[model samples]
Target chain A: MPILSVKDLQVTFDVRSAGSWPWTPPRKLHAVGGLSFDLEPGQTVGLVGESGSGKSTVARALVGTVPASGGQILFEGQDLAAMSPQERRRHRKDVQMVFQDPLAALNPRMTVGDIVAEPLVTHHPETSRAEVKKRVGDIMERVGLLPNLVNRYPHEFSGGQCQRIGIARALVMKPKLLICDEPVSALDVSVQAQVVNLLRDLQRDMGLSMIFIAHDLSVVKHISDRIVVMYLGRIMESGPAREVTLRPRHPYTQALISSVPIPDPVLEKARPRPILEGELPSPLSPPSGCVFRTRCPKAKPDCAEPKDRIQREGEVQVACPYQEVKDALAV
Target chain B: MKLASGDAKLLDETAQLASIRGRSLWADARGRFLRNRAALLGLIVLVLVAIFALFGGYFAKYEPDYVDFSLMGANAYRGVPSFESGHYFGVDFDGRDLFARTVQGTGISMLVGVVGALVAVVVGTLYGATAGYIGGRVDNIMMRTVDILMSIPFMFVLILMLVIFGRSMFMLFLGIGLISWLDMSRIARGQTLSIKNKEFVEAAVATGVRPFTIILRHVVPNLLGIVIVYSTLLVPQMIIFESFISYLGLGIQEPQTSLGALINQGAEQMNNGTLWMLAFPLFFFLVTLFAFFFVGDGLRDALDPKDR
Candidate 1:
């Protein structure tokens, strides 16, 4: 059985208007609209999407940071959505998250020692301070932060160091699953590589399951075992990483993969760019049938059929009905 | 190549650490603050004033309220500034020692100011933090109530309370503190609004830290810089407000004299050529205000995170 399974998860935000009128009804914005996926133990799943795609929302919901509007998030066959606050707190020991902006994610007032040990203090209160210190020092050293800098504040560290601190904080809890929400997006390109490499090393060493969310397909490609492509608030394509990136079945996924620049100039020039067109429609009123249909080059009249159904061809899941036909035509 | 560079980087980091030393945020803030002459001067003056308020009575030759009829004799007691015998700052109309009274009055003024400001700090911080953290509809309602309180003519209400309650120590503290918190709460609320959404607070929540603990530990600790600066400024204002009420004969009455009451008495006796009576009290009052202003200004510079 999968270690984690999100079944038809939904997250809706209420956009309340400012008015003097007392009877104004709040407008509902469906940020995450009925998305589902699964994570196997010790495997990394990259959730690829752009801003407002509800990729981050999914990460937030799974980590128990954001409340789900509706759905069942089963961790070892137990429903996360139905758990009480105390039960949810106990569940957090098995799961952890590393947020995007490293500096912003750390308390400026706290020392490196305090920031990393905070989770242990919160979740495992009976653990002695000396034990916490030893663990925190070990984890910090593991993440390439000198244990001597434990007394230093977050502002004293560089961006890369801060991210390492963030990583160390997540890993110190010894969680089974680590959800990194665009962990490298806010970093410099050179720094991004180091952090990604560190993550890959930790995941390998720890045998940890991970859900890495990022808009950069290339960044996620190196670390993720499988890829789940999202457009707006729904998954467009999902399968093994190489297959999804190399032989993308969905038009949106193909466009996204084609956009990643190949380092070899000759091949990069030779390959045709599957450039997508049009703005992503507002999630308030997404395009009928397919969320990606508005920007999809292969969008047909059948694409407006009100509900696009996911069809599995072997291992890969494609949301479009004519995906097989399209795949054949492309070949 | 990676291993060589990694070793070189480690050496570079060690060198950097050697140069930097271990400087704490508080130490850095103090260093920056000391560079500001005005703030430093204010700090010095404020410290001296606090000492005087605390230990000024030890130097008093006579009780502040003691009336020496023998010294009054024929001049109706008002005496010019002299260092003869025990009359340090001359004498008042009732033969009370001006220097002793001025020194002792610091106690009441300091008490009123410090206590009033403390009350404001406690109330404002709690109200604002709760409102800002538990936002949405709760925020709207709490802030609206604050707005209503702010809109009212606060001085009129203060005066009414003084009139009804008759200037007891409790009323003086309550009247000033209650009105003063209006501004403090607004400042605190604004700070909390900006801080509550910071990624660290989100990180705290993600780490499964309880909401109350997050607010108390993370949110409130970060707010200390602003709160300390604001509270220091409030003390002087509360002192001034107390003096103003007392000046109007509704504050510290009779045997319980404040700097304001002393100044009022001095102002009345100025025409009689007993200028020493007025000068000493006015001097003390002005010095106290200046000390507080300087200290408050210094604190603002010192506690500012931007300085670091």
Candidate 2:
């Protein structure tokens, strides 16, 4: 059974009253539009897209960080939208989020032990203070942090340790699923790999499921069981991470994979130059048919109508009008 | 079995967080704040001022309220009002001990200032936090109320309160406190609004912590610097306000005197051309204000996150 399911999710923000410089009338920016996905137990699903793809919004909405405009988020068996404020609080323990920025994620005034232990203290108010301190120390050790450093502030820790702190914060809840929003995007490349490996190890050991969101397809390809590609608030393609990375179906996906710089000089020079047509259109009023059509190299007349959803079996889903080409590319 | 697994997992998680606690923003701010000599000295002066208010008048030899018609306008107290005679500050119009009264009055001025500042902090924090956190209609309403209060003649409001309740120290403090908190609320609201949307706050919410706890724990703690700087800077201003009211003859009226009332009384005896009568208390008041300002400005500099 899928551990979590999100169906037809939509998030809209009213950007009314034109901006000061060249003000425009109130237009709604549809952030997350009709997105659906299911995460299996002990699986990592990478939600990949650029800045305005609404990947972060989906992550936030799943954890109830931001309220969903219209959607049903089912975790285990319960629907989050139907839960009361109090009920949501209880459910929050099952799904925790590891934020993007490590430095700003923590409470600046709190001790490292206190920041990690805060969730337990809040949810389990009956626990004794001494027990709380001990539990905090234990979690620190599990994250490979020395117990002696429990009292140290976040500033004393390096970027990698800070991400570890963030990860520990999520893990301390003993959650079934973790939502990591670009967790290692800020770290150096080498440190990013280390953190990614640590996360994979922790996920394996703890049996923790995750919804990893990031713009870097290369990193996600390594860690994710499945990858979902998004553009302008709509899913462009999705399937096994290996399948999507190795044989990209959509033109957009091919462009993205081709953009990754090859370390080998010969391969780098010989790689196909799949140039993107234009800058990704504003997600606010994205082009009609397929949201990626404006940039799709093989966009047909039918591609503008988004209702013409394209699908090919035994491979990732695609929304291009040139389904045959995409299917050919997949093989 | 489930419990043990979850517990073990929790243990691992908690340990990681323990390493985080030793390096937070508040600890750094507190360390930097403690090193500020001006704030520390201001704190010392504020405490000493409180002590003087509590047990200071006991040093006087006789009742300061004694009504001796024979000594009316004597320009001195207990003994004749004379320079170099150790009745140092001389006397008031009623020949009361000016030095004793001034010392005794320090308590009232400090009390009024503190009470006023406290009211301001409470009201201002609530107003500012509410206005800042919840934008749109509610924020607009609260801020507009503040604006209306600001536009009105504050002195008129004080005068109205005093006219209705008279010059009792309680009413005076209450009235002054009510007026002073408006600025604090505005400052607090502005700060709360800015910090409300910060990433840390969103992180707190994402963790499933209640809203109120977030406001108190995260939001308020960040505002400590603003509160401290504003409160310290406010003392001298509050003292001056009380003094000005006293100077206007509407504050801390008779036996229960204030620095302002005392200064006014000293000014009355200035017709005798004796400088010591007015100079001493006025100088004390000025120096106290100066110290508070130095401390307040220093604390502001040290606690400022932007400081290089």
Candidate 3:
């Protein structure tokens, strides 16, 4: 069975109108509208999207940081939305999250050892202090941090080192599933590779399932087993990582892939990439029908009609209806 | 089990690195505070004033309330500072030794300031953190209540409290504490509003740390720098308020005088040329206030995380 199966998950926020009276009605912001995905044990799913495409919201919903407004989140065949608060707390140990800003994710006042040992102490109060220390030390070493530096504060460390500390803290619980919310977005390029490689190594060693959320497609494609492309809170395309990046079916996915610059200067100049026009539509008032239609180059009059279904094409699930037309046009 | 020479050297170096001590946030702030000359001088003066308050009474020639009938009326000129007579600060209009009165007033003023500020910090931090963290309708209601309370004239409330509860040291602390916490709560709430959304707070929630624990462990500790700075500044304000109350004759009664009460009496007798009474208490009070302000300013610069 899949470790986590989210079916039609929806998250909405009530935002007050600017400069409006308190009595005025609040607008509904559909941050993650009907997102569904499954994570098998030890499988890594890369959730790629632009800013405000609800990528982080999906991670937040899974970790129970933000409440899911609708749908079922089945973890080990148990409905997370149906669980009591105590049960939810119990489940938190099995699922952990790594944040985007490394330093900001760590408590400035806490020692590195205390930060890493927090989850273990919180969940298993019966565990001995020696055991907690051993676990924290082991996780710190596993995350490429020196165990001797446990007394240091977050600010004393570099961004890369802080990210390592964050990773250690998350993995200290030995969680079955890890959600990384743009973990390396704030690091230098060299440090980004180190952290990503470290995460991949840790996953291989522990047989951990992960949901890696980022706006950088190249990084996502490098570390993910499968990739899910999202735009304006809806999945535009999802398939095997290699297939989704190489043979993108949806126009939106094709545009996203084309936007990635090749390393070789010659190939980078030769590639014809279509720059996406217009700003991302506000989540408070998202475009009708396929949310990507307003930005899609292959947009048709029918694309405006609301369609709640996603079509399957072999290994890929795509929201665009004109996949064949786009394919023919590409040829 | 013998290792290569290079590997052994590497291991030795690692041990040396491990043994190097780390500086905690408090340690770093203390270092910064020591480097600030103004703050260091202020702390030194404050300590001296505190020592005077605690031990100066023992050295006084007469008790604080001792009435000198010989120095009363026409013979009051003999009350001036004289090495032989041992009345270093002369006598007050009530025939009390000015030196003893100043020492006693210092102790009372310091106690009120510190105690009142402690009450404000504890009550304000908790109230504001709760409202800010819980947010939504609860925050609105809680903050609105603060606003309503803030609108009422605090001095009037203090006077009303003293009248209803009858004047006592504890009642004075309560009155000053109750009114002082309003501003503290507002500052705390504003800080918490920004702090609650910080990623560390979310990380704590994701770890399933209980809400109360999150507040105590994550929220409150992060607030320490600001709270400490604010509390130091608050101490002087508390002293001033207590002194004002005493000046109005509603505080400290007759036998037990405060700096404000002493100053009021000293001012009344200033035209009569008994200037030592006024000079002695005023000097102590002003020095104490300046010391607290300097310390508070130093703490703000020292504890500011951005400075690092």
Which candidate's lDDT is highest?
Answer: 3
Best by DockQ: 3
Better of 1 and 2 by TM-score: 1
lDDT of 3 at B286: 100
The per-model DockQ list reads: 0.48, 0.43, 0.72
**Which should have the higher DockQ, number 2 or number 3?**
3
lDDT of 2 by residue, A179-227 (tens): 9999999899998998899889989999999999999999999999999
Off by over 4 Å in 2: A18-26, A323-331, B1-55, B67-70, B76-86
Per-residue alpha-carbon lDDT of model 3 for B81-153, expressed as tens digits? 7767767788888778888999999999999999888988998988888888889999999999999998989
DockQ order of candidates, best first? Answer: 3, 1, 2
Model 3 over residues A1-331: C-alpha lDDT tens digits? Answer: 8999999999999898789999988888999988888888999999998898999999999999898999999989998877877789989998999999999999988998899999999999999989988899899989988888888888899999999999999999899999999999999999999999999999999999999999999999999998999998888889899888877888878787777777888877876777799989999888788788788788888877887548897778988778742331132
Tens digits of per-residue lDDT for model 2, B212-305:
7887888887786798789878878899999998888998878878888888877877767555667767876876787778778877877787
**If the candidates were sorted by their TM-score against the true structure, best first, what order would they fall in?**
3, 1, 2
- After superposition, the stretches of candidate 1 with alpha carbons farther than 4 Å from their true spots are A20-22, A324-331, B1-22, B71-78, B305-308
On the 0 to 100 scale, the lDDT of residue A59 in model 2 is 86
Q: In model 2 chain A, which range of ten residues has the least summed lDDT?
A: A322-331
Ten-residue segment with the worst summed lDDT in candidate 1 chain A? Answer: A322-331
